[model samples]
Target chain A: MTDSVFLDSIQPLFQDIHAHFTSQPDLNPQAAWDELVQSGFLRLLLPESAEGAGLSVAEALPVLMAAGYWALPLPYVETALLYAALPDALADAIDGNLALAVGTCGPGEPAQPLRLGLHCLDALVTAKDGGITVAPVSGDVEQGWRLQGEVTPLSQVLDIRLLGTAAECLQLAGAMQRVLELTVDYANTRQQFGRPIGKYQALQQQISVMTGHCHSAVMAAQLAAGGMQRSNTGLSLDHHRVAAACGMIKAACQPVVSTAHAVHGAIGVTEEYELHHYTRRLLAGRLAGGSESRWFEQVGQACLDSGASVFDFTLANLS
Target chain B: MIPWPQRQTLPASAEALRSEVRAFLVAHPPAAAADVRARSWMGFDAAFSQALGERGWVGLTLPTQYGGGGGSAFDRYVILEELLAAGAPVSAHWIADRQSAPLLLRFGSDSQRRELLPRICAGELYFCIGMSEPGAGSDLASVSTRAVPNDQGWLLNGSKLWTTNADRCHYMIALARTSGQHGDRQQGLSQLLVDLSLPGITIRPIRDLAGDAHFNEVFFDNVQLPHDALIGAEGDGWQQVTAELAFERSGPERILSAMALLECWCDWLRLCEADTGDQRTLGELVSRLAVLRSLSLSITAQLAQGQSPVIPAALVKDLGTTFEQDIPAMLADQIGRRGGEHGRVELMRTLAYTSIIAPTYSLRGGTREILRGLIARGMGLR
Candidate 1:
């Protein structure tokens, strides 16, 4: 089936799950993830030989993008990364654990423990010193997931970051998409001096900038997804380009989020409106892979260390 | 939904074509240094354009019967991506290969195509666009250049300002009033294929802020033209130009304008002992480029399918130009913080050049404000 058809099959399931979470007061993410896992979405990236769907990163990106579209608050991104990168830590996730991917920014601080799916059985994975390690939540949860952090090489961590950031970016991209939707919807309906506010050039430009960013975020997420696909095949990843892409998108979306809120006005700021759900994720996901600054700094490092070879690199691995 | 332009997968043959493009770039490098070379599409080099023609890269997408490669838009995109990345001077044949040739094929007579297209593909001819009159830049509908009908064809008696390469180009595709007065607006506009060599045509070069004289003012004092000079149905210039722009706006050039600066900056960065902060910043720039590229490629893919995606194309030019302009501003700051005292002069030269000319990025391909309006309309916001 085509990617859109495959995505169409799973989108309604997510919307149903979205309805379930939105109906709850606390936004309990557990039930929806359990349903998703049961539906085999959690194993969408697992090798088919392992009885999983064996979908490539390119194929799986749309799934996460869909989850993002509905403002999904699950740990699918982390779970997929852990399953693909560290199969040793796969039991708890397969045994009904809601895997929350831990993302930490800055130099010294450890990745924060899972808040939505916190448990002794749930595993938390993080990148450290050019590698990644997956450790289960253990005693004195404040020191959770890092008690036995094991280094696993740069490529594995990049794969996870590539996947994790792709997920975060996709969701944020979705959120931006939603914000654009909200803005467009609002522009067409919101009357100022009698006609729709969209008739004004000022408002139009604001929405246009938002459109630019929204489309950009979506494109960035797709590129990262496609990049990881190449890396997953044991081919060259152009880690420099991937790092830049994953990181650049977060930075790129900052203005988009703010512009979306501005165009949406006060109603967007309220918790009563659905805009906050996606806007909130837009901010949180900005830091999911790493803060924009952190990722961009890594990109600069790649350019420095990559020497002349990096100059030949294009944005996509297609080149 | 926030306009999620569908991600298009490239053809399987793209890889082989991409390799060939890279090999061609490696074989034919531009003579300009890191700074001057970064001008990309704005940088003019006749020899380089001729060499590209020799390699069958000039008009690869045109039909083979017209002495073209009969390649896809994606093929042209791949070749352009490589050239732009290397900061190749593509201005010589830029206008002709990009929009002129395509427009000719779409609207030109069979004789026009069979005659002009072969030379265009061979890089033996160059064409400049005459859309932006001094008073009618963004408001294209207000164009007043009149082409009064004559027994033979038309008598053109107006000037085209801000015409790129008019001083050096062999021909021009100008929009002139044919049927109505200025009040008629887009209703009376018509496209004319004018030969620069014709009498009564005067091209006065206009040097821009970057010390480049690539722009010009071509005044026509009752210039005579044959009946065939008129392209497409008369009074359809507005619609034809609008369609031609979809091709012009959607290309790898939009993102690759500052590529030379980016490449040079990255090369300088590689030599420096960069910290994590510096590294990430550089990575972020590349990331932005890659993402913009995906958006650009999406439009090209649509073009390859013979579909004119005006909205996405507008977004690419708007967003892509924003990124292009940012390269100069961001790198100026980067050089001060990182370049230290070494090679600061060279870095500043590029920054200065880019910064000076950067304002035109949005202005050239339908100003950002105009494009945003189009994008807004596309999104159904207006």
Candidate 2:
């Protein structure tokens, strides 16, 4: 599974970011962005000719995962996605924290709420007029490129949405892992009825179910990430990618979220404990951009439209 | 942490294998009815299995020395996907191809492997697992079956309950107490490769809810086994059987049990204009299937790399079975809501068969509770 040599080489960068955030949860956004830029993190998806790291979305998935692991309060996930989707020249010229937006950013259109680190966003990457449009938060457009037809832009928008959702799903997977660890630690230590709660069959059952959900969440995210990578390279049915992203988000929003707290009992609710950081972000990520129902509907329609059998459809898109 | 490694797509080589399997299925499609095909791996046809054996598709993972193909796990995975997606009847040699051969290869003695592996690879021998007993279902460690030492070898007593296809199988790898008492649980247990033709053995087929007689209750009345029947070292049955369960739980069989019915439903959806609700339901089911397959494939990769991945396998089986059961339940809801307007008679028939057999998905291999407990312990919760 660890086939990417470049991913292996950049392991320390992810570790450094994880370590930095774990130590200083309140670190300034600009300071973190500068450190990331110096490490060539934002340029990971750019081509080598542009002095970028030349990493695929699949290769840089771990970075997004680490962002969720530490609950890093920055726009690294959005910025990384933009780098993957934007043109090489424009990606090279970008110089500030990035955020993603959907829908046309027309003059009379209402202000879009940035999914993450809104105050830190320099440019908002959005879809407008059948193409990718970059609108600075200051109400001036930096670059606007229109493609030939409505279909391409819609597909591009779908790709961006799928990538963004998949990225957040990876983050959710990371946070879920930490939540599992925290709940497991608590279950093993917290005494109940004169014994460790973890020893009880009841608690063990719930934690086991939680563990299953955590593993499934990871699987869902990886499926989506594979879709993202394939969408970048060449031909892939959009329905499968949309379906995978929906699955990822739905898994993240499952009962695992609440069960983590249930295992922690009252201690999980206290601010002194660290569980809320990951849990809160997990909750937000599920509702961000588009909900699971919306994306799932697209997949549903696609399934109906695809003339192939469901098995063939899955093999065509998923494999 | 659950070692959910990064997702890896099948190699380019898999496409060739997949095409071959699909072509083979088209040439030798299961002649059973739609509902029978909905049974998928549970539908038994010895002739079809022998046909697969002739094509070197039966025991693809076993070494060639045993008359096998000596292929990797991915190769078998590819063939299995096509077979399952087409609802091929593979139950005749399912247990042997899936785990019995692997168990024997790993824990059986040289003579035992030499005698049995070839037949298994040829799909001439059918094997059933004798793990659960009348008293022990999910509590497998509490098995009461006894294999006491005797002048002949061992005198086996007690019975195995819920043993699938025991009547048709040539042999059984039974978990019995070799030394310890009943409450000793996992201790003193040994797996014995019992020839089902032994004089004192009796097998009775049990009828399931779906009117199928796949389940059997096997009674051993002082059935004697030779000295060479013992698999692996004495008192190592628990470990051997645990490894065997991993193989049983992590395969494509666990997740693709309802593919036949699903394919049928999708065909109907295409013919009839499905409403948004029907579309959403199919979409949800498809998404879950994609993710579950991804999880199962990850475990297969781990197995390829020589990792047991016990917990991940258990987790997959649990989630996979849940997804399997959800197919019929969700389809039932959709079919119920439409008042038979969109549901074809054929689709309803397949759905009825699938719905009746869905509960077995969780009960077979390992029950949901037992699997969850294993996962919890793996997470260090117990």
Candidate 3:
């Protein structure tokens, strides 16, 4: 699908959903999820052939940004990934029957799989022994299903599939960008010492650093999106580059987001304010698709293999 | 259909230029004995530069009438990447080939171009930057150097610090205030192409922490030059200098200065494959290095498109230098205890040199603080 048309369709839906999400005095995750699913966002990443938008990553960036702008509480990103990775039949089922629970489950000690609720139809699990298993999930929203022995963040026993971590990273990055923008604007207009705090060189420098993070994150997301779009066959180096870039985004963004709160001072942490929601989302995003240190190690390993000069392969890649 | 992020398409002519530069570097690989490859941007293998000039590689972007290749900026950028990547010792001709010729081509008069362009393109003439003062640093507007208008053109009397290759250059493009106070920071400044050999001018080498006399303190006292020496109209120095800096700050030189050292380190890492811990350390370093290279090349592509991404360029330089400096420190931390091991001494010396020279990385084109200031301004913080 063309980017413009996709953007046009999703942007207003995002705005309406975001407005409804933020107007509440506090986060209502269940209500927000109902609104998102009702608005068809939960199916945005699913293939059109499966009765969904099948929107590309680039087309989904605006929705992510909007979600970040309003500090949406629903696990839209995780659900989007789940939908993208669902088997054709499952995707069709979810599209036709919108009330089903979809979650990623991976192997672990004592194997605690992801549990959305007892209402989940099926859980996707990838086992330690290189086996894929689909286990029926039977529970209600009140009592979460125990698919595996133990309940870990993303580990579960029902079913499993490969999902795009880049989308998750991009969603977090976009949210961070919004947080930074709001913080910088607040710093500029909000006065301290009888002047806007941004006038202080130290504050200005901090904001500048934050801006760099935002810029790098956006660039990294774009490069990753480009890779996903253009390359059918991925190289180890591609994984290294994309993973490293995402790692950098996290490393640069996580602290910057927290600092944005600090820069905002007391007003930011209050439950009434939207800042905490954004920060929470940022933290959750960091945990998704591996931690910053893991990606850093991956990038470091790639660089070491090509010898210590990153420029060698990078330059050749550019040429 | 969605348009791709504008891919950089190399011009057909650029392909030819790249081949020509590659052939030239192969034929005249700057004298290998002086450890010239290690010098990177500072290495001034005069013979190699002269050979490039002879082949019209120098001043490749200047107008054809002015004895240049009359090529586009992309053409010059292609050549520059190849030369710097190869660690060509073109330092003697670096400023001239990179900035001076272009500056003169844009602002120099017919006679000025005729007299200087041919020699510059021929690689016989070299130019040194006379922008930084002892106190000024990146604050070009704060330059106290003055040139009083006199009957014999202008009586130039001011000193320039960190003037690279001042002792060897034929001329220096000194940014001097012609008619303004420090408060009028950027106003009334003018660029004068002063002859280095002229009377009353003294070039004293200042050895850096690396024990290399790559920079100098050039004292211009009552230096006399004809009216033709003025690069542009009077009081146009601020604009002229800004343009020159854009050239200085953008390019592979800012990132690749320590590339050869990195190559050496990689070789050493491969030779010591049995050392698992050392291998792991090498792995981490390489990853950061790769990300930095991509960042640098992306900026280069921006530059090739004639986009004056000064802030982005500064960002690249700032990050690039930090990475370059980190290499030696990281390597040192890994190998400090293994100093007595075979081949460790050579690596140790190279590491030591890189460590000492690393501080200048930020200082050379612009300091980190100055770059951040620029970045902040670009981000609308100032």
Against the true structure, whose DockQ is highest? 2
Ranking of candidates on lDDT, top first: 2, 1, 3
Which interface RMSD values do the candidates have, in the order shown? 2.8, 2.1, 4.6
lDDT of 1 at A268: 77
Provide DockQ values for all models, in the order shown: 0.52, 0.54, 0.25
Model 3 captures what fraction of native contacts?
0.25
How displaced is residue B186 in candidate 3, in Å?
1.7
Q: For candidate 3, give the lDDT of residue B69.
A: 80
Query: How much DockQ does model 2 earn?
Result: 0.54
TM-score of every model versus the real structure: 0.89, 0.91, 0.83
Give the lowest summed-lDDT range of ten residues in model 1 chain A.
A113-122
Q: Pick the candidate with the highest TM-score.
A: 2
Off by over 4 Å in 2: A1-26, A89-92, A95-110, A114-117, A138-158, A230-239, B340-342
Task: Show where candidate 1 strays beyond 4 Å.
Answer: A1-3, A23-29, A48-51, A88-100, A103-111, A114-121, A126-163, A230-241, A315-319, B1-3, B8-12, B17-28, B40-43, B338-344
lDDT of 1 by residue, B192-264 (tens): 9999999999999998777778899989998999999999999999999999999989687888787777766
> What DockQ results for candidate 3?
0.25
Q: How many residue pairs clash in all the candidates, one count each?
A: 15, 0, 20
lDDT of residue A196 for candidate 2: 92
Per-residue lDDT value at A306 in model 1 = 49
